[model samples]
Target: MDIHYRNEPPQFDGANLQMHFIAEVDGEPLDCAITAEALEDHFGAQSALEGPLREAFQRGQTLIRAVCTRAIEQGAGPVVLHSGRFRSPDVPDVLH
Candidate 1:
């Protein structure tokens, strides 16, 4: 899985921050977008959602939470986060 911050030079004018998360498993790709504020709520303002991301990383699930957390801390302002699963061949049947 790869986490990247989109919209070069994240804006911090109180606007929503956008992040892109890409997950690949067995050559299949899963992409998702999420925001900063949502990340802040989930992982606090000083830390990333590494736990959730790790969970996804281990379970082969498409995770965007960590990417969003970084985007927000990098200056992406208050954000409205959104996420979903994409095409993934190695995703486990049940996510722990």
Candidate 2:
């Protein structure tokens, strides 16, 4: 499956405490999100506030996309990236 990420800006979902972004898998749009906890733990986010979370999302977007791709390839739907996902040994330390 081919994954193409959109150039759209991520939006902060205060209710969910996550940042939502869009992607396309084989031309079909897919919803994806990364939790605030993941951003704080791995992306150098100082706080869960909008500004910091957005900055962190931008800074770590490439790695985030890669993770999303892996998840999609594994048959995940509407990817929801959490802190626990990054705690696995397979994920790189550079994100920490």
Candidate 3:
């Protein structure tokens, strides 16, 4: 199983960042929120990531990976975030 997402530009909030995103698994909508703080816990010091959107999208990818990991750990079967031509399932590669 794989998941794909389309994320909006992140909304910054003090020490946190939130990305509004939409995802689909088996082609069904799965609305989710990707936050920088959460990513920091999982990834650490995202503020050092250089650009704003770049960091935001990176957090989005971390969110996707976390979800997949949780599913797999629960014996939910193999899952991955489909990749195509360097495309990001959670957020756009370029800054918006």
Q: Which stretches of candidate 2 lie over 4 Å from their true place?
A: none
User: Could you tell which candidate, 2 or 3, scores higher by TM-score?
Assistant: 2
lDDT of 3 by residue, 1-96 (tens): 556555554334344354435555666655444454444443443562336534645645654545644544455443323322123343333411
Q: What is the alpha-carbon RMSD of candidate 3 to the true structure?
A: 9.7
RMSD of each: 11.5, 1.2, 9.7
**Candidate 2 lDDT tens digits, 1-96:** 889999999989999999999989999999999999999998899999999999999999998998888889999999999988887777766755
TM-score of each: 0.30, 0.94, 0.39
Each candidate's lDDT (Cα)? Answer: 0.37, 0.92, 0.45
Single out the weakest 10-residue window by summed lDDT for candidate 1.
7-16
Quick one: RMSD of model 2?
A: 1.2
Ranking, lDDT, top scorer first: 2, 3, 1
Alpha-carbon deviation at 60 in model 3, angstroms: 6.9
Count clashing residue pairs per candidate. 0, 0, 0
Give the Cα-based TM-score of candidate 1 against the true structure.
Answer: 0.30
Q: Judged by TM-score relative to the true structure, which candidate is superior, 1 or 3?
A: 3
* Model 1: residue 94 alpha-carbon error in angstroms: 16
